[model samples]
Target: MSSTRSDVSVLIPFSKRNKDQEEALRQCPSVQMSDLIFSDIEEKETLLDYVQRVKKLVTEENINIILPTCDLSTMVHAAIARDFPHIPGPTVESCYLAFHKAYSRQYLDPAADLVPYAVVDLDSPTMLQDAERALEKVGFPAFVKPAAAQSTFGVAKVKNYQDMNRALQNLRTMRDEHPGFKSSPSAPFFKDYFKQYLDVEKYPLALRDVVIVEPYMDAEALYTVDGCVVDNEIVRWAITDEHRFDHGDAKFGQDLIAPTSNVRRLTEAALGCL
Candidate 1:
């Protein structure tokens, strides 16, 4: 039987100022209003520390469940769930694979995939050779981005070598500024990466060790699933279409609909595969 009095913790990675977040919190009957707003800056250790603190709080405050309410929070929660069997949610490795564009595509498991992609090490000179091959494979009008990034922050749509060079230069600068970009566990292996493709002195590459090159997807429509899981089984769920502003930031759509038949089938398959 469910406990009469319950304590729940909801972690939102970005910020509480987001309107969709505010609305989501407003609607949650189980979550306390005060237990909100956890932020993660560029610091990696902060995340490790935050999870440890949350684990302690769960015991002291009796946090029955931890809800990952945003893109970043999902990662944080997933990691915590790995070590603490009591912390219920997606595992860190699962969330990491899904969040990464390069890895996410692998899970799609399509014979002739909608998106064409390649993974590279932006720090290696051989990356140019690798990129040339990838370009030939994906063709022109490709999208280049950090392997593990969110939104359209470092994303570039390039049509030629000249455009690709300029875009790569800009991405290298962003990489220097964001440490998490370079420090991923998978960064060291890519033979051709940021080094071959960028000017490190000017860009001052920070550490985005891996990069993903892909054909630009014609994403006219996008959707997301917000769900809760107990024992790796999804329970409560809300499916929402992603509506973007001029800046391309996504939130709860004004028009809400259940997942598309295709998306539902695909998501179920993906989950089962997980």
Candidate 2:
């Protein structure tokens, strides 16, 4: 298909409402645009519910493409993309491997120097015990984060056993408070979704329940690339270097600048591995 706006029906999923996206679509003039409510797995609405709702909207509205602006929405759209071929994003398998930290670690199998980490499954009855073991292996000055979460929701830096325990306790409290869908099978819409991508017996813990313990890196800069794969070819779009505000214990992105060729190539090499 041509890259013309007239030939595409784009659907963007937002956590609440986004006036920016609406304004961007208005400027386009020829594109068909719609919104899909973005639901967190920890929220009252389940992932299945969100996907089913989106699938129905796509069918009724004839949405030809999904532009997932959030991590949760990316996974949701990727899961259902098989039914709707025009969604421009990663495949279901790739999304599962990439979005889930633990699974991605296993799939990528990065060099020891690149990533030294261990996965802890919170769904297990012995999660605390497993975490303790992981702590011992990863040692002090490490990070504990949910395997499939985004926006640094369940991320913490721990320096000692006491800190690790406190972090784990906080994560457990969050999980207890947010208990996701009681049963996936009970939701008829999830039948096909599960059959296509899920194997509960194999991966006992859901993606969200998995956690990773990894050594902390005191990095001075962060870089990212925005790209896509079309016709089995990787296309580079843009690269930017992220500047962050460091506040003793935490860091947040403050600005982004287009990097030079050398930095862009380095970032491209990293993306190639993925």
Candidate 3:
């Protein structure tokens, strides 16, 4: 969890979240990492049980103001914020929408001009039919991944049926290496909280460990808007505009200051350092 310590941003890395990816992540020039305790829900442990378990540590260690830093931690952030109302964070429904691509596509609907896509359950009896329908709607050279993923850990670009199978194999392999992903059996609390807002009978695929098949977005430039919220006000920070791979790695990733469109500078904002 990322927090603010006396106005200096501090990040506490949890072992369960990073696990096998820890070393690869530390190689990034910008990350500030520390050796922290591992956090996870044991078998038969309820969400409240897990939350209370972590809460004890939080209070004992004087942890305050935990904000999520990525897609995987959004639900965890919501749970923590729910326990401590004084600590601000996104709501369970909002976090669910952001964390799951299939639901996000459903929620966005006709409002957004998104490409056609399908949500396929890999373990479902109708898995083949689902994939067929997905590819039919979305078309070739599609991008695929587990409905929920952190970073691009399980994502792949596929051009045909064989490629899709290969992508799922890679995804399953990653899940084995890195546990706690929503793609697998999620924590009880994470699923329980979602039940409040979603109708399981109507959208069974919403919370299931499914795969989302959609057309690959090959953009010349990809951008990310990073910011913080305080008292309902959004404090816009740096806007990172990154180019595609150079030697299999991002060629040029630069941050533009303050706002969208009318970016006046080339350097990163203070938050970028965090």
Candidate 4:
């Protein structure tokens, strides 16, 4: 807010093995960014540790905002926002709400004109059957993604039984390997002898407990409305053209113009209806 603090510091997870990290480093302004990564050589620098470290750095550096763009970072960002008041961020809870398809849908009227969704319980023995039911309810070639996911990392559009089965299996496997999936103390994976060989769950139960089956919307032209909430009001808003060409030719068309006043109003109303 001041001339001395005019520069905004953005903290993002970085890794040498990641091409995105390399690209980000190359493109980012030298004085306006900080990268944090966990390494075996860095004491107490686990993924969770990296999150806390970044938050601390944000405070010390007087960062204006924190934007978490990935699943891991978003989870950490939400946790810090929900638990710690010291962390500097805008509407972490709102972002957290957006992270889950099920919760996001809760705030909306079910009968509203929007995409359809079905909830598949994770602990059910007839899990596949439930998924199939959801498919039947939503119609074929439906979008399937972890209800708690951010990106289209595990998303798929299945048209038939075989593809559906394969997708279900893949999602189940993903849940198994999730770092946040907790094993029972009595479970074999938790036993002292086998613990070392176990893989941590990648996401927490809040994310992995349910699956969202939806009729994918046509977003050939997509745009993201970025805003900052201050004093419980949307103080500053900007429109960015969403572009994602890598994740299965899913390009966010920048040619699509930002929503005009009437369109913006409709979009906000639609978002409210989830």
Candidate 5:
């Protein structure tokens, strides 16, 4: 609430890549910095544990604001925003709806023209039968991915039933190794392994339990809009044209270019629908 940066104390969760982020914030000179241990949602921690930890940290440090820089942190922060109203981010409901691909697809179904034809809740007992029907409807070259994951962790492209089965097998393997997905809460964390499974019943509202299958649109370029909504107003920021590697299936961004007028207008219109 203070106009001067000297009065502002920021609490950023410690991440592996926080060095660059910390350096960036330190450039402001007057902003007080503090670190909160970053907790992965899909790890050993329960919803209660995560909330208690963050609540304790904010209360003890008297944090003025929270800026979540990753997907896991954003979800946790949004869920506990009522405890710290000074934090600037989306509401818990909005974050849940947006973070879960299946939920977002269903929510935006009325505006169906904007979304790709997709099937939801692929982790059910009738998954094979449902997938066969969905594939018939949506056609081949479809994408199979976890409903709530980051960095394309469990994402795969399936051209046929064989590819779909293989992708599903890989996902199952990931789930089996997941700490949260284990039968017991006492399971040890595998530091070298990355898990992408979410316990649906335990954290139903905050986490996604299923996978989504959607028709993949071949686009000339991929664009992303980065912005914030303040006081119910959508603020437009930079739109970047994402460049991808052509060599393999590793779908990582190679470069970014500022959007043109046409791309900007389209991105704004898409944001308006949300």
Candidate 6:
């Protein structure tokens, strides 16, 4: 491989969303970005085609990095980077476990120290029974979200079983109408992959439609720890304090203040997420 430009060039697997990131990148002469009409990963065929398309672009443009612009692109970027050998990205297996909340809980440490949660497969024959058990685990005043989602889109705060029923019903019949569900890079792309590529008995969440139910964590404050892993070492940066607006129930982050503190707990939490 020949290196031409000293400046960095990146390929975002998804199309340009005219986001603030694009504007910010334009201000930096040291950075260049490439995007196309690409959208969500609906299936395995689309995932493979996207991988090949990125491979060609990376070679032709001499792109130095393949960046994932959204949650859906994590695994896709991993697939593209596999061929380059030099491009550094998370492995597909790691990304797979990370992106799906239930999967993360199942395969990772399970965050037993955190709130106990439940996973209910929407398509399961025992869904109602599972939900009943989930309610028992989480009880009233619960938070619900998709098994895999983009940001806070499909998330909802439920004070009762009625709310859970409505949320689950929307997830079943009105998925397209759900903002969080639509915002996601679309489709439960892992469904078929689990059948063909992995052990279904071990990772059965992929076998059916699933959602997460957990106790609502009420806090007077929230913080996000920013950091990066370099050469397999994790370094702490700054922690951002957040305040969420009450959406009839507390939901959205209305205000953010960064560099709020240099706390060791922040670093520990950030590493846990990674």
Best lDDT goes to which candidate?
6
Backbone clash pairs for candidate 3 read none
lDDT of 2 by residue, 249-274 (tens): 75544465765444333222222222
Each prediction's Cα RMSD?
A: 8.9, 6.7, 8.4, 9.9, 7.5, 6.4
Model 2 stretches astray by more than 4 angstroms: 1-7, 15-43, 85-89, 109-113, 180-196, 236-248, 252-274
Query: Order the candidates by lDDT, highest first — what do you get?
Result: 6, 2, 3, 5, 1, 4
The TM-score leader among the candidates is 2
lDDT: the better of candidates 1 and 4 = 1
TM-score of 6: 0.71
Model 1 regions more than 4 Å off: 1-46, 110-114, 178-208, 218-274
Listed in order, each prediction's TM-score against the native is 0.63, 0.73, 0.64, 0.56, 0.71, 0.71
lDDT of 6 at 201: 82
Alpha carbon lDDT of residue 53, candidate 4?
68
Query: Residues 187-226, candidate 5, lDDT per residue (tens digit)?
Result: 1221111122233354352332466788866666777776
Instruction: Tell me the tens digit of each residue's lDDT in model 4 across 1-274.
Output: 2122224344443222445543543343222333433212133243445555665765666543344434345545554454456455434456545655676887687789877778776667988899889988988767776665443556677777677778777766765665333211111212221122112242233423567788755576566675544445663344655434434533322233444333332222212211
Q: What are the per-residue Cα lDDT tens digits for candidate 6 across 90-125?
A: 666677787778877777565457777898877678
lDDT of 1 by residue, 1-274 (tens): 2222234444444344566545644443433344544444444444444555666655565544455545556665665566567656675556655656665776686876476678766777887777777788888878777776554456667778776677666666665665444223223322122243224454332234566787765566767666655455664455666543333322213344665433333222222212
Residues 42-78 of candidate 3 have per-residue lDDT tens digits of: 6555444556577776666555445344454556667
Pick the winner on TM-score between candidates 1 and 4.
1
RMSD of 5: 7.5
Worst 10 residues of 1 by lDDT: 265-274
Whole-model lDDT, model 4: 0.50
Question: Where does the lowest 10-residue lDDT sum fall in candidate 3?
Answer: 262-271
